[model samples]
Target: MTEFQILVVAAAFIVAGIAKGAIGIGLPPIAVGIMTLAVPLDDALAIMAIPTLTTNVWQAIYGRGLLRLFRRFWTLALTATIALVVVAATLGKLGSAQASAWLGVMLVVYSTIALLAWRPRVSRQTERWMNPLMGIASGAVAGITGIAAVPFLPYMQSLDINKDDLVQALGILFIFLIGALTFALFRQGAFDTANTIGGLAAIVPTSIGVWLGQKSRDALSPEMFRRVFLIGLLGLGLHMARGLL
Candidate 1:
């Protein structure tokens, strides 16, 4: 890869990291969009997967009091996510552009639903079933579009799981989803020398972007953070839509 390409990938990673740090999501859509501008869609997807997995793993492991939470939900969540990966691998060759378009639509729909009545308040009697059901939905979405956060977000919000647990759960889910997708990509021979190097090179700038995001998070008020995150979703959704057009 050229020096320019390396710079682009690194920049994407930094942005992705910051997104993860601040909102606990947005890394894949944000990073993949930026990387796609620098490289092919497939390569961009591959590049983002590594860092997505890496950072989330760190968050899941190091975030305070995650182990007990993991033990509680791991079975249902992991199983469903794996099932989704199997389905995704079977269909991934349909084309990355198609996947992007579908993802864009899903994101817009989910975000709209989220914004309309963003706070999901579940009754006590129905709460027990929420996790497994959302797990299946999340896994299915992840399998299809490689973006699983939407399904789980509302469920997580409804429960109002503590912030730390929420972050850890997201981290764990991302790691499993990414890990499965990576294996599928490998089996399909998606990784080549150029893309591998490109992915690694992109990590530098991506990390920088993360740092910048973190700094901004410290300065932003709650309302400001929500607004910024929404704007980001719109921007990324449009970017993905462009691939379809």
Candidate 2:
């Protein structure tokens, strides 16, 4: 990576870190979305994988009863992993342009839902089947677009879990999907050594940003900030999709 790309990569991760720190999620979507402006979509995703995985590992373990939650959501994890690998190996081969377009679509769709706060509740009776089924769709989207914030986030939010448990659940799900994504990208030769090193280098800035964001979380209204951030991403997504038009 050139110096410019390196700087962009660091900045992207830092911003992603802030978002995640404040809201307990959003690291991958922000990091990869920003990096795609200065690098290829594959490179952006590769550079994002390590930071995302590391942060989510912490998020996954910080809460109580991780094992219990994992057991409850294991089906979601398994199906998501399988779908990620298969879809990435298949549709992810459609090249950068198609992937970029898909990324934009996901970002726009996710942002719209978040902005509207239109969450459809999933009752306990239907969750058993819905979890695994949604996992397939979520993983397919994450695989092709390298953004795992759509169906998965929404589905999880719709469940009856409390705030803290919801955070841990998302973390566990991300670990599985992102791990699968990393392997798939490597198998496809999209995540090479340069991307790996770049991703490693991003950890510092990402850490600092998260720390700062966590500090600010006490002072700022996270909901308001999230709205602003989502709006920015909505615009970025639209810009990326313009080529497809």
Candidate 3:
């Protein structure tokens, strides 16, 4: 990678980290979306591997409810994780442009949902089936777009779970999801020297951004930040959506 590309990735991770620190989400999309402006989608996803794995692992265990969440959502996690691998095995099927378009659609869907504060309701009876279904769908989407927060998040939001528990649940699920993504990328031979270095270099800035964002939480309104983030995501999604056109 050129020096400029490295700097772009580092800046992206730092910004992503700040958003994650402030909101407990936004790292992957924010980082990948920005990095794609200067790098390829495959390279951006490759560079994100380390930071995503480390952060998700930390967040999952921090709540001290890993076991409980895992037990409850094991089916969803397992199916989604497996589906990620299975779908990514066909990595040859998608060109970079197609993946970018998919990412754009996902961002649009996710941002629209969040912006409107729309969430579905899931009863315990329906969850027995919906769980695995959502998992399969979520995994497929992540496999292609390298973004994991879309359908999975919305499905999780629909369930009767506490906020804290939900956060931990994401940690557990991403452990499987990100792990699968990384492994899949390797199997597809997507990793390279520069991408590996980029992933490693990202860790520091991401940490700093998260720290700064956490500190700013007291002074900033999460609601307002969320709105702004969604709007930006919407615009970025639209930009990427041009690939579909």
Report model 1's TM-score to 2 decimal places.
Answer: 0.85
Measured by TM-score, how close is model 2 to the native structure?
A: 0.97
User: Which ten contiguous residues of candidate 3 have the minimum total lDDT?
Assistant: 88-97
Comparing 2 with 3 on TM-score, the higher-scoring candidate is 2
Instruction: Compute the lDDT of residue 18 as modeled in candidate 1.
Output: 71
Candidate 3 regions with alpha-carbon error over 4 angstroms: 91-95
Model 1: lowest-lDDT 10 consecutive positions: 221-230
Error of 2 at 54 (Å): 0.4
Q: Between candidates 1 and 2, name the one with more favorable TM-score.
A: 2
**TM-score of model number 3:** 0.96
**Judged by lDDT against the true structure, how good is candidate 3?**
0.86
Ranking by lDDT: 3, 2, 1
Model 1: per-residue Cα lDDT over 113-226, one tens digit each = 655767868764575676677777777776767666576677667764677787787777677777776776676677888887766666566577667777777887644665
Using lDDT, give the best candidate's number: 3
The C-alpha TM-scores of every prediction are: 0.85, 0.97, 0.96
Shift in Å, residue 27, candidate 3: 1.0
